[model samples]
Target: MRGLKKEARLPTVYEVIGVLILFIVIMFGFINLLELPIQLALFTSWFMVIGLGLWIGLRYKKLQDGLLQGISNGLEAVLILITVGALIGTWIAGGIVPSIIYYGLSVISPNIFLFATLIICALTSLATGTSFGTAGTAGIAMIGIGQSFGIPLPLVAGAVISGAYVGDKLSPLSDTTVMTASLTKVDIIEHIKSMLYVSGPAFGIASLLFIFVGFFYVGNSVDLTRAEEAMGALQGQFNISWYMLVPPLIVIALLAMKQPSIPTITFGAFLGVIWGFAFQGIPFLDAIQTSYQGYSIDSGIEFMDTLLNSGGMVSMLEVILLILLALGLGGLMEAAGILHVICQTLLKWADNAGKTTLTTLIAAFFGNFFGGAAYVSVITGSKITEENYDRLNIDKRVLSRNTEAGGTITTPMVPWSDGGVFMAVTLGVSTMAYLPFLWFHFLVIIITLLYGFTGKFIWYTKGKEYTENYEDSTVNTTKFEA
Candidate 1:
């Protein structure tokens, strides 16, 4: 397969542009006119786009090998998502989720509303290592509380999304983070450290915004009856105890140890099943069923039931389906050299190192926009940007970091991307509605571009050499430079 890397002729600039326009039209129809489920739309796009990509590949005659390689590359991510679904399902059923709510509600107050939102969403996103999961689960819970308090739903949703992305960007366990580092071949730890330049400032600004927003926002007093009823329902449904906390703690421990995500999530899922039987008095078969089908507890209180009863692999089917379709499309694109053609065309216009960096970043952004998945963005961006990086004498880590900062972090802002779809669905707001409000995502993109142009805080080795033990030795000399 490696031998297939011969210099295949690229499509003309017009052909590349035409393909992009075609992709946009299909996406527009899928989102605006068809109004299909995000996953279904993604799948459909992949089928059509990949077919086109493959047809292009066949002209070069190495398309089959490329498709195989792309699938091979993506296999691990597919497995990881499945495990994540299981882990979350088990964690919820075993009472870890409910336990957090039970304890969290104990300290509930209106004054620190924004701070609380940040903290809760951060913790949940860190635990799940998925901004989407965090938003789907704890975000919903926070929204419920916000509604009860009569806070503006949009503001509450914004806070939840902000905090969730913070964890998604930072968590070593996050798929996008890992995939970013992996595709770029950067040390995961280094990649994270590098991200601080952008993520830290974005987070601080977002936090301050939430704080200021919360200060002027008036919310109703907490309803004691509703809280009490929710608490009672939880107590009756599960043996909600501190012991239920073990599964989440274990997940964190595994992540901190830098264990692979699939195994870590799988372990957590198994532990969840054990907890379900031991504490919740869930029958073994029923527990299995619930774990797969998402258990629903019919506690008398509407909000209480809404909070307590979720855990099931079945719930993630839509996501799985979408991924499969998207992967298929990605496979086809790789086979057809459609992405390569686009990259080569873009590179022709890049005149300087800074311009090259900026171009690569733009390419990544468009990759996410076109591909509709963060993983696709990183993988495609990394493959395409490496030549530009080498030509510019930039560090591979720079390329990798740019891939993430440009592709992964910006995904939620694109309405058709995986993160955007989930955010919109979870928050009950269109991606376009909240796109302007996602200052963090936009900030990361702009900061990445600025840093690329100025070389501010950009570290690298000075020579054009590749080695397994490469490290950044260049210091920031810009402080005194003209």
Candidate 2:
């Protein structure tokens, strides 16, 4: 478990091939047969896949060390997930989430619902550095509002999630973004800037799609009935004042000043708890309940209770579980060198920059086929393509761009991936239901491939400049050589 031994290691090729086969069987049982609940199926598959890895690692007496190494390697991500849970709990108790929901609902207009969903979710995601948080806090409210307006639910959720993921993918404060950059040894700003080539077009196209979709939203006769009722209910439950906005504002301010994510989120959560107690005069028990079990208030409206009563550490458990399971699967794959094998196999198809870029995109796309998260895909794909990019004289920027485009940005479209599952659950929509409306992800994938085909985005430098820019700086450690 501590590390790979010299003689007992399995070949990367077999490891990757086995992983692919295992996932295919799992996907078949879940998606085609519909044999179990999605969550259960996911958990079961993750366990089975990891069990296989453990079995292979256990062939030698050193298996215990390998297991410990695997778990230890995952410690950072586990801490991040735990902090995320705490952050969600505190945000709800603090009134920051409620405030955002209140204001977000106030701005709703049928004429601009789609674009508005995008903008609001994007801002929320940027603030929280979490698409899941944005979706749970604002996406649900938008969905309810959209339903009230007689707009299509899936399309609204799609626009909202697309925008949310955009911010989540780009924000320096995002855990996934930070993890990707750290794992790849790229500066966060450089990685973000590099993504602009792909993400920019995707965002624009998604916005345009939302605009077009908005036109189809035929106004629902302006339903102030529900809105008024919900607002009144909200006011009755909490001290509805401007002051409730301070904590979230401060969190954003801290992020702008380049504070670290765990601390920043923890700070926001702490202030949220304070707001819950001070303004609402919630009892200590109630404060604890609200932070962990969520708040419950009767506001003379059933829907309002359902909406406001949502929060707590408990609300985020599903997502937190998903993260743990998905990351566990990823850890096993890393331990088995499955990722390296997959990368090696794919690199053989790249004969030119165009092919190399396409191959990278394909590798990323296939990553979700194994049911992990976007950060896993991006890091794995980036490492896989680094050597190929250098050999083909492609810039590292190009490699980074493709990885973000096909791996990071597109994860939410795959139902098995962490981002996808989280978004669907948060918005109360199915992944397939919103697939057509996720124009941003599609656009990014398309633009990246198009650039590859046209050779427009490809840069080949000769002499010191090319050597300096295109040379691979990727660190190598597939086996536990040490």
Candidate 3:
């Protein structure tokens, strides 16, 4: 809708495919061969999209409009990212995050350590509705504890990522979950309930795998000396009190009550500042500064310093820029009619519900690969597949779940993708090193695909017809006829 040229010709599916392959090749060359940053690679790819649009005869004005529209769609998400970064900084400075790490370390033993890590990170991410925040906070502590227990960092990173993403997929506060629901016109709660069909089983299996793997490492002699030292450093740095948890609890309570994300997270950050002042004896000026510039702890231990020195609005600028660039590329592709061509070709094969779901899954995966962002995939994939879902009598919740199943889960697997790069950089682990250990990632995809082929857990509508009603120039609504 953003880029419509009445006289412009649409590209053929084959032509679009050619352009896609070329784009992938260029991205690979930049990222793998030249070792460019993912942001730079994406920026370069944006130029490619622009060139293709121009060569295909798309007007510059239309392309510009499309790019602006795409960037505008992500403005809200960008603001949330910045706020989450600030929350992380304030929480760390307030001793909230450290308290979690400190208390979490106390009960976890080598035997059930990996399993406990998965559960703890999962709950934290679910409560916070942020995988990145969970990883940067609780996940960091788990890594330290795992290292102290002689567990491989790669394995720990994998479990942490797996748990973090599980919540990111299911939590109502998650941006991806919200985006999927909004795009598909499903109630957010219903969308979350629908995901439970797939996520519930996947998480159970993943938890069991971690437990089984933990058995082999149980009772292994570990040097608790390093862990004790790290704990001491944490205790000495900030006031270690149970009251530190009040801030995150406030956040969870607000989210459970269905408060909007921006205000909810902002309130949480403010509570962190209050706690920092009241309990941690942090100066008012310092607390305010940390909200913008991030928390800093010079612990002398490089690992502890690395883990503690994070957060603030400034920390998220790179990710924000990456989202904008990726969306800009998506806009150009849409303007040139490349995405329309591809979607139309894919729809040609969707004769039934199962095939349509599978087509959607495939489209979302490729969309993340091409678009370089999960939200971009959701927007494009949902728009392209909505009519198909309607014609097949499938519930929109199914489409929303599949969009997350394919787009959200697949983003962190693609090495050059925004999610992947952010995870790798944040966790201090290579993407390749942690890839094999992400059981939830692999399981979610496999289970979703299995459900698609078997028609298991696919919801269907009964005796209801969907009708679009346009009441005025500014008001359009969908009506359900029973």
Candidate 4:
């Protein structure tokens, strides 16, 4: 990995802003006007970075080194992404994910269906640590069940997305959680602990909203015939046993012990393969193959087939590429001193801890909106604001928490973004249709900003003295000026 040379000239703030505007225009033009996929759009942006570096008078070697350094930082996350993909494939084949959905479906009644939908999806996503996986599997089942109960599709979609993302933000197994912790140099457990102060309240309030909504549809009678048929098809294809839970349980236990993420997730994937072979009676060869090619189920039920037939190492290739390309662009900007210059400009306004936190939050949202990926937003926000946080004596965990609160939760709100597009396509509901019902997403933004302004949960550190202070720290505006 390359470090920025002290002698390298930094780009001016106006030049950085111009490059950013150009970058956004190119990306939006490709994705919206030209109708290209996100991968191609990202590729086009990488070239823009190269051109920007040259225009700024940076040597080619310096720019290339920055790109490589940025890509290197994400290598561990990429491995974890591939491992989680394999885990999903094997978990489905082993009946782990299916069992959760099957059991969740069996317990819900029409009256509490909406509330239960949120809880079930949350639990499934917590277990799998993947919002997309949860959405494609249990989320589909919830949609079918909700339709059967005559609930509005948008409401159901909202509950599913909210619950799925809650787990994605909190779960130890979640890639976003891992990436956030790593980027901020905070212990994974500490990052999660800090997040609870924000996510816990947001999730609780959202659940209550779902419950309130549930009251209206409680007595409305509808058929459960289709849901039963789907459950039957799942049961027929897989063993659907409690024993399938061993893998996720082990993962949680290991994470609680503060075990490293990569090995823990890899072990979980291996346990899933063993369980599939031993209990599900999947052929040994097929179990191994599924880790790479994904689980294949021919239940003859179209919806069931669509939901269950996902995961495997191949499924993560797009995400891996996106991370690499986005990080590369970030690296090029850093190498050319553009990121540092812009962040320094932002720091001019961050005269206090509260304003610093708010600045990070604002930057994160803009990162998701302009960068077009949650990973990009997280990396960009964390990298730029980390030193400002350090200078303000703020705990890194708080930085990681805010990054996720703003970046991860806001991506799905942008309709053209990859996260938004995936959720809309998976649930067959437009992003705009479900936008109003996404209480959890909206709540996170509000809660984080509230905490920033109010300093309710800010953790402070100054030269080894740690304290939890709820009172807002007075802004020393002149102390942090360049």
| Residue range 300-414, candidate 3, lDDT tens digits | 8777787778878888787777777876777767667777677767787898877888778877876676666777778666877777887778888899988888888888887
> Mind giving the per-residue lDDT tens digits that candidate 2 earns over 1-482?
65744343444566557667777777678867977655566667655655555554434224334434444544554454445455555555656555655665576667787898898888877776777656755676677666545566788888888888887778877777776676556788987887777787878888877877676544534465666666655566666667877876686677666677567666666677787778778765667556567666666776555545665667667766665555555555555556656666777778887788887877776555453567567766676677777676676777877777767777877775777766775566788999888887788888888889898767764663323332233323333322
Q: lDDT of all the models against the reference?
A: 0.67, 0.67, 0.78, 0.75
Compare the candidates by TM-score and give the number of the best one. 3
Query: Per-candidate TM vs. native?
Result: 0.79, 0.82, 0.86, 0.75
Model 3, position 212, has a per-residue lDDT of: 83
**Which TM-score value belongs to model 1?**
0.79
Candidate 1 — what's its lDDT?
Answer: 0.67
Clashes of each: 1, 6, 0, 0
Measured by lDDT, the strongest candidate is 3
Off by over 4 Å in 1: 1-9, 37-72, 120-161, 164-168, 171-190, 218-229, 395-397, 414-437, 459-482
Candidate 1: C-alpha RMSD to true structure equals: 7.6
Sorting all predicted structures by TM-score, with the top scorer first, yields: 3, 2, 1, 4
Per-residue lDDT for 274 in model 4?
A: 92
Candidate 1 positional error at 83, Å: 2.9
Expressed as tens digits, the lDDT of each residue in 250-300 for candidate 1 is 776676566766676778788888888888888877666665776677777
Runs with alpha carbons beyond 4 Å of true place in candidate 3: 1-6, 125-137, 140-144, 147-150, 172-175, 185-190, 218-222, 394-397, 415-418, 430-432, 459-482
RMSD of each: 7.6, 4.6, 5.5, 6.7
